[model samples]
Target: MLIGYTRVSTDDQHLDNQRSALRAAGCQRIYEEKISGAKRARPELNKLLDHMREGDVLVATRLDRLALATRDLLELAEILNRAGVGLRSLGEPWADTTSPSGKMVLTVFSGIAEFERSLIAERTTAGRLAAKSKGIRFGRPPKLSAEQIALGHRLSSEGTSVREVARMLNCHHATLYRAIGTYITPADSN
Candidate 1:
């Protein structure tokens, strides 16, 4: 069985062309969807996958219509392979997983994709390290400054309630406690 999957990024786009192409390529059952390839959850695509069985081939008009990312495409191929199903793209004839040459091409492509991901991760780590070395801070800035922290400590020592001090400083009581290194006990509060 040659099952077909068709998708469009938006409702404005039509799936007619893809459907015709898949039909011409001998697709027995066609699943249509109007959703972005970037989205992870595609109901029609999932349904089509679920409907496929061993010895069946999933056909798409183009590789991009199936998945926008190389990782995603490779993952789908892996799932099909595990289930004894094959994947075929009319636009990218070399992407047919039913043939030996196509499988070899997919393997090579997956290796290249993995290498590209590793390179991206390495570059990101290096960029973050360089930024840190240049005194660039990440995450939220401290709510209380050094002077504010000192004032919080003094206020806590002087029998002011943690909540009162926090209210005066316009911060949370927990923030004031962290700044002062103490949580004023209820017995000590005025």
Candidate 2:
């Protein structure tokens, strides 16, 4: 059994061409979807996978139609292999998991994709380090400056209520407590 899967990114896009091609390629049952490939969940694709069994073949018009990312494509291939099902792409002959050459090609592609991901990670880390060296700070700025925090501590120590200190500093009582490293106890407030 050759089960076909076709997808278009948007509702406005048509699946006629993919449908005709899948039909021509001898697909017995076809599942069509109009959804973004970037999305992880596709109802029609899930249904097609569930419907497939051992000795069944899954066909797609193109590799992009099945998955946008290399990792996703490899994962789907692994799932099919584990289930004793084969994956075939009409546009990409090397993606046919049923043949030895196709398997070899897929392995090589996986390696390349992994290498690319490592390179990206290295570049991002280096970029962040460079920015930090240039005195560029990340994340939210402190709510209170050092001078403001010292003033808050002084006011709290002088029997001022947390709410009154917070109002004087133009910040919340929680922020004032965090800045001063202490809350005003009932004895201190008195």
lDDT per residue (tens digit) for residues 1-190 in model 1: 9999999999999988998998999998999999999997999999998999999999998999989988999989999999999999998999999999999999999899889999999999999999999999999998998778778888878999989999999999998888777434444776
Distance from true location, Cα of 47 in model 1, Å: 3.5
What's the TM-score of each model vs. the native? 0.76, 0.70
Q: C-alpha displacement of 73 in model 2, angstroms?
A: 3.7
> Ten consecutive residues with minimal summed lDDT in candidate 1?
181-190
Clash statistics: count for each candidate: 0, 0
> What is candidate 2's lDDT per residue for 1-190, written digit by digit as tens?
9999999999999999999999999999999999999887999999999999999999999999999988898888888988999999999898898899998887888788789889999999999999999999888998888778777887778899989989988999999888777434445768
In order, the Cα lDDT scores of the candidates are 0.91, 0.90
The reply for model 1, stretches above 4 Å from the true place, is 10-13, 38-41, 50-56, 79-85, 181-190
Q: Please report the TM-score between candidate 1 and the true structure.
A: 0.76
Clashes in predicted model 1: 0
